[model samples]
Target: MSESFNQEQNPSEEKFTSSFPPKPIVEEKSQNALRRSLISLAIYALMFYFLFDRNIVYIAAILLVLIIHEMGHFLFMKLFNYSNVKIFIIPLLGAFTSGKKQQVSQWQLSLIILAGPLPGIIIGCLLFWLNKDLKNETIEMLYSSFLVINLLNCLPFFPLDGGRLIETLFFKENYIIRLVFGIISIIVLLFLFAYLNPILLIVPVIIGLELYNENKHQKIREYLKHEKINYHVDYVNLPDKDYWLIRDCLIFSFPKKYNLLTPGKYEYAIVEPIVIQQINAVLQVNLNPDLNLFKRVLMVLFYIGIFVGPILLFLLNR
Candidate 1:
């Protein structure tokens, strides 16, 4: 994806920025923040020890690979001028990079998703090649683990790098489609674990928890949609990719728009018409509703290949 943004500013940018009310700021004590950080580090260290059976070398190698993977994501986010870029390590599962994006294109999103895994995959390949001659058990183990971790991270499951790519490429504007895919992904993972490694049921359990959280948030949005109140319309110039995020924020944070001047006693609306109109204009500029059948088929095949290819190779080698 092209990294460059259009230099020309929209004429409405000033008007848009001026219309919205300022967001409230929350203050936090530095000491409190420092204490929380220390606690989190302690927990992470304990988890790392338990996870790797106190193998210092293994822990160091794993952390290195994970940091590289996250750096790939962070770099791209920085390139795109995303705010508050940070990587959080989830003791057992993996690391995730998050940032605040005002707007992003689909291709830009794809680049970010691939960034999280591609660098690690490349480094893993290089390590595997270098260790091919020496055949040192530790180096070989690290090489294999690196490759396997990255490949697995590309699976078509929610909260994974591959799943994020799939969502951007295929489910772009449709919340329902993404939700349904998330559910199906959980089911597929459950069956795969049952057949291959029941001990890995934790994978699906984590995904299930993610889905539950999303559902809970969705319910809150639904409630907000029906609440009776009025809101002044604020125009913001946003890209097509950001429409959904902004819409979701509006759904959860504000009451239904009633009237321009006063709160309508009975009328209810999810958002003001002007807001929808602006969003639609942005959508019209970039929306591609249909993914071709051939590409869709290829994506499905790619998903299957990533999930099954490694297992087949391992068995064949054995």
Candidate 2:
């Protein structure tokens, strides 16, 4: 009994380490906000001229739906004490809220992303029910459009609330995974669109190509930034295991001025590289994700939704 107890105690007492550090909570300015808002305003204006100008009453109705959808994001973020929330409406696409980097857990992110569509869908259903008495083709078309748009937006595709929600659900390992999934999504979109309207297939293809190229550039940039390491200090104390967290926080805090450079050498200066061979150097790091059956199940369901939703929509509608 004493030997068994000693063996268990020794194993438990052994030190453990990790290869990667905890990622810091980053709160960078959301470029999505300004761009989304401007685009939304432009779309709304165009839509007003084309669709709603004929019937002012419809404008108010659509606005109400958009408000409800955006409010879902705003309210939840606010509830969780997130900052810098703003909402804007895109004509056919629906509304979006940007700003507020909630270092959200997987569940929180899933819920937040899911929140936008639920309200819009529910409201649309209610409108369809309440406005059933009205027989006007325009109003009926408008009601159906709202319902369709809301449901379609729930399809997992990037930049869309649903896509973001799906990403959150699986806690995408990295941006590359997202790009790959985005490509798959585009292929599926193209196939679905081919029957209904071949011309529309171009849309997803274009989006996918653009995203892929952009991500490629981003990866190159990150590699260039981290490739060559230079230490200014005389003594190099190895980074703590939680260095990534610190790095991310610093990056957010100083987006414009977060590069390694000497003060006097603005023109650029090259230095000789020093090589040191050490067989066993201690490095610090954090814990790996503790994934289990439940998380795996959720991931499977999320991906299934991604691959199947668009195909189902197209087939059912067709």
Candidate 3:
């Protein structure tokens, strides 16, 4: 079903023509993405410095730990042939590695999740035991910081690596169950904000935005499915008509979010980039997730062991 980029618009935006396959407005090279990643990481570090008011040593150590943690996920994603993999450091929050893939393996996805925190936790525990007697203040702080951040990430809170592992293994296909888990994550995170640093409340705020975005994407996907619009393909392969169609859907979905935008207009808007970003987000490869119950059970045990193994090792060494 071929359609004009602006099927509903007047004889305007003539330059915007639908082609056989779509082209991205800007080419997002891995090198450029990596450079942006570095810039963002620098910004995150500076923000962390101002937020914590800790000794420079603590800030440096925390930054190093986050880099290592995200690298663990990044490297594994590369190993699994994930495209567009990049680490994003969220200011005053945390870091995450993002990539795109159409047919994801459940086992590999589980490894990618574990890969982030497990190694950092293990290394931190090792450093702690090795320095128990020496007690160098920097090493002590570094290891403690590593344990705290990575261990918190291991918690089954949505958007965290551990929560993602659980969601992927069990509720990946279960929308109702996933929604319930998301609500629980929100409540728990609110409690955490009341207990921990209020600045960290930005995390819950981001999670709320994520939930809103997810709902919008879900609705878009359902509508597309009803209209028999193909979207299972990766980003680059998305047709121009489909892109415009999704953009209209997004504008309709978030009118207030993207104020002053009308659906079905082909005129390029100031928020085109953001709208394109959402289209990319809404387009996903159907997860292969070739995981059976037995494999999933084993993955769960492995997930638990990531937390328990380090503690067991530290206790035994102590």
Candidate 4:
């Protein structure tokens, strides 16, 4: 934690800038490799203290798997020009890299998202292939953990790599398609929760609930489509002031014929039916103001887990 803080504070840290979005933010620079070294040393010291000193080798193996998995996303995201990357190892849940929220095409997003779990699966397979004998317990355990974690990450649930793939690859332009996806995800999770451990159950429940709540607004949105665009949300209310509404949106509009939008596609039109000589257009939307309390609550809980729940898990599982 100290090292993480120092990385943020280090004045000489490398920075990347961008101009497409006006504010060129740091794209993806690891602050002082020395800070990372210190953090790794600290984590090792702590893990060694807790997981039996002799288990240091196993812990290190786990860290290696995690780093490779996260680097998959980090590397690919950089290749695609996602700036200001911050890769952090999150215990229990694995790792992730966050960067500038760039507007991406569906294909690009799919590739970026698929990059994370593919590497994990590849590495797990490689490990299994290398030790077909499976005589060493440490290698066996590592192999199993990697396979389990990677497979679980493969499940389609948002914010998860698989979910991102679905959003990017199989994404449909219609609200009905997304609604179907949400419903199917819930049904699959119901059966999954029944067969899985309680600890794993929470993950799907949280994700499913979020999907359901988000989809609940779909009906209202569809109903409003027949009407002219009159709805809009004040950006000031957003946690991130620059946030834009995704799915079932109207990017731009004209008086009689509003241009409709789908998840990752754009729809644009000239305001006049015979505007061969002149053009003037504006975007209008009937923003649904209804908040999904359940999703909001679950999101808060998920964030709490990200920050504090892992520490509790370490203690309980220790």
Task: Tell me which of candidates 1 and 4 scores higher on lDDT.
Answer: 1
Query: Tens digit of lDDT per residue, candidate 3, span 197-231?
Result: 88877787878888877877887777787668887
lDDT of 1 by residue, 232-297 (tens): 112234333233333433333233432231211112244445445433322322434344667666
C-alpha lDDT of candidate 3 relative to the true structure: 0.79
For candidate 4, the per-residue lDDT at 283 reads: 17
Alpha-carbon runs more than 4 Å astray in model 1: 1-23, 26-42, 51-54, 191-203, 219-318
Residue 262: error of model 3 in Å? 3.4
Give me the displacement of residue 225 in model 2, in angstroms: 9.1
After superposition, candidate 2 runs with Cα above 4 Å error: 1-43, 51-54, 89-95, 131-142, 190-206, 217-318
Among these predicted structures, which one has the highest TM-score? 3
**Highest-lDDT candidate:** 3
Candidate 3 TM-score to native: 0.87
lDDT of 2 by residue, 258-313 (tens): 44522211121122011010100111112134445598577657645544654464
Cand. 4 Cα-lDDT? 0.48
TM-score pick, better of 1 and 3: 3
Candidates 2 and 3 compared: the better one by TM-score is: 3
- Per-model TM against the reference: 0.61, 0.53, 0.87, 0.49
The local distance difference test score of model 2 is 0.52
